[model samples]
Target chain A: MRHQTALNPREGDVLPPFEKTLTPVDLMAYGAATWDWYACHYNDAAARDLGLSAPFVDGQMWGAWFARQLRAYCGPQAFVGGMKLRYHAMCFAGDHVECRAVITSVSPLADGTEIEVSQQIEKAGTRVASCISVVILPATGVAETDSEHSAGKATEEGIRT
Target chain B: MSDLLSDEIRALIGAERYYPAHEEIGGAAIRYFAIAVGDTDPIYVDDAAARRQGYSGRIAPPTFVVETGQYAGNTPSANGYIPHEWPWPKGFRTIRGGQDYVFKRPIVPSDRISVRYRLESVEAKSSRDGRGQLLAVSLAEYLDAAGAIVATNRELFFLQPLEAGQ
Candidate 1:
């Protein structure tokens, strides 16, 4: 299915902020789904035993949250080319994690507009993680995945290599 | 190098691993993942709702590939990718440092998915918790049955050794 609206991001455009107060139930569900049953994400007592104040959320889960925000802003058609992230502080269950993203640059390609978006997760005013996403907004009148005419069809190797 | 992170682990860098067969993106897996991530999007669970959006049927979230395509290792799943054991130093534990994902298309239920991974790089470092250790990196790729690349995930892992002989 297609989302009727398409997200046309301009340089310096900041998307709306999304927030969630992660609960234990949320953590448990994520653990069961992802097969990451690490104690640090589910057992508070185990976490304290390991010297942590409380059980924290999975690092990948944070990435997923950011993806959700970007997908909502860019619409369903835009491809999430890649994300680069660094973990700084731990985000525990019950902590409020605010997710935000801003377009840093817009490079026009033959097939679409490749935008660099910077994202982050902050808890209580302190940054918990920093991320950058490369999203390709297909040009108007361009066919999806038509490599011949699409702009900036940067492959995965382009991002890491 | 610490006795824990031996040269053997470093040699693993540049290795390419592939799963034996492709697995289907079944509905149950998508449902479990949607509930786990706390995502309330109807398109992930309700086919009728997803149909409204134009999908042929219920579609999996972009990240669902992580679990369904995970390498099963010696404990490989009956119908999943072959498990590629993490190449950390013996006796050393590992922690996730970061992750990156590139999605070519959204995965829908009934789609057959195949997975492969390459050990991209390995580096030696020291963290507050250890005198000397290793930071390993790997990239996993997900492909559809037609051979189209669907997604790529890059993961960073920190490995630290334990004191000799427990």
Candidate 2:
């Protein structure tokens, strides 16, 4: 198993930002995958009708990317407690979106740690969306089993991890 | 022009609308979603890997439920499409403003899921460019075949009128 990320993130700690340039293909695939099929994500004419520059990325895609990053950072053992996003601006296809995170607070539980992270997605240096993610980190000795093991332990132990 | 925030629309607050139909989670859809999100998690695609992780079978990415039957599912209407679900002003364009998600369990292929939604709140707001519109907040809950709540989402949508000129 790969070394897990140390759960010792400090308040005001900044995680390395994730960067990606979204493409039309990415948008199209996401639309199909999510069954969104919304015109603003696909048809250029439809976007123009909406007075948009071009087909834009779905906001849910932003949430998905956030979830992926959290899973990767917290490792498979961590239970994502909750996530909240505030969309501030639009990100069009072909726009470079960068996701950045900062640890807002960390609270230790009986079996693990609960971390709150403030995150944001920026397009060309402009804030497109801001998010808050709360995750329950497994206890230090707990082997990272996919959630089942840890969740049961969480309930039995009253740790809420 | 009719006010977008009509009394009837405001009355919808706290009214729960249940999408009476259920859709089975399919492996193909899960795989496609995994690909779309650029998530290479084997547990999302490989049954063996998923089983090893103690899941019943191949499980889906945490965010996968956000799309489960969102646009393609049974509705009260015969066509299966819920028109004007957004409750925005007539001809005003609506866009996703934000979302909050909480997951209790992983949704696996063949799991039958149902959805229920309610308008949580509606507030009048202006964009940075100074266009006035309504921001609607709604909550949707996903339930499994056994009627256990698996996930929930609080979604925010921005309703913009065309005359505002972007």
Candidate 3:
């Protein structure tokens, strides 16, 4: 759960790329729990009936997966501002999903560090999920070390104003 | 062309329901989601560390929204699992295509989060394999306690059948 650094991406600063091989349990879990019981995510008969190659994974699952991928690089306090992903290919259960990211650009912003992240999730070299993440890092002057981010981003407000 | 189906789908957007998840719920979701990702951030846990960071208390991980909001509009399920409950012929596979999320502001505790859902549009397109398939896409807006738009979600799902044996 402890996070890694995502602020500076040097030429070879590639955090370990991740590959997750999903099982039917993964798909079924999505269906049963997260209100995502789409047969393509679980039932093979449903997949073939619907004209898919195999039972695919849940998009919401990937939502979390994408966040996890970024978390791996950005450390804990990475504030995701805007996220957009296009699903290019189908990710079937039992397929090893490879998720990765490259820090496309890092710039200092008024509020904090602006880290624009380019992300990809591939299954055997085929892109499954491709995304761009705009994350707000701790303020440069304030966040001297990753430990400050360990708690969470500083907030100006709580539940009750 | 007729927008009848589009209109009908648009009508399918139901009344908004605000699932009031408090700090505990926020913390639980952050824990679960982090567990799924194998993250061990103090923000996710270690309240003392959180206090040290001047957060007052621990803050849930960012993607905690998925945990708090992903299953927002679930229909009842026979099993223990949460079902998508989309009105379609039974036994069709559903695959989430993608999402476009715009976070107007960071999520915080005590916020009465409400997701306003609308059927953006649905269209039948020819799959890469040359088969005509239905793509149902919807949009949901996450509103804060004061009702300001916190985030906008545009999601697409490919409805198909499950594949052959595992």
Q: Best-fitting candidate, measured by TM-score?
A: 2
Give the interface RMSD of candidate 3: 6.3
> What TM-score number comes out for model 2?
0.83
Q: Write the per-residue lDDT of candidate 2 for residues A1-161, one digit (tens) a residue.
A: 43433466678976555678888989888877876666677778878877888988878788877777676566555677788988888888778888877889999999889999998889878999888999887676434544322222222122110
Q: Assess each prediction's global lDDT (C-alpha) against the native.
A: 0.69, 0.73, 0.59
Q: Please report the candidate that would top DockQ against the real structure.
A: 2
Which is better, 1 or 3, measured by DockQ? 3
Tell me what TM-score chain B of candidate 1 gets against the true chain B: 0.84
Q: Report the C-alpha lDDT of model 3 over B1-166, residue by residue, as the tens digit.
A: 1222345444555523344433234565555555655456566666666554446666656655543434354544442234323454544445567788777654544455666665655666566655345577777776676778877777787654334441
Instruction: Provide the lDDT at A154 for model 3.
Output: 23
> Runs in model 1 with CA error above 4 Å?
A1-4, A44-53, A138-161, B1-4, B48-54, B67-87, B162-166
Clashes of 3: 20
Q: Give the chain A TM-score for each candidate.
A: 0.82, 0.83, 0.76
Candidate order by decreasing DockQ: 2, 3, 1
Instruction: Write down the worst ten-residue block by lDDT for model 2 chain A.
Output: A152-161
- How well does chain B match by TM-score in each candidate? 0.84, 0.81, 0.69
Cα error of candidate 1 at position A28, Å: 1.0
- How high a TM-score does candidate 1 get? 0.78
Determine which window of 10 residues in candidate 1 chain B has minimal summed lDDT: B73-82
DockQ scores for all predicted structures? 0.21, 0.32, 0.29
Best by lDDT: 2
Provide TM-scores for the models.
0.78, 0.83, 0.73
Please give the TM-score that candidate 3 achieves against the real structure: 0.73
**Candidate 1 lDDT by residue in tens digits, A52-124:** 6887777777777776666556644456777887777778888987787789998988988898989998999
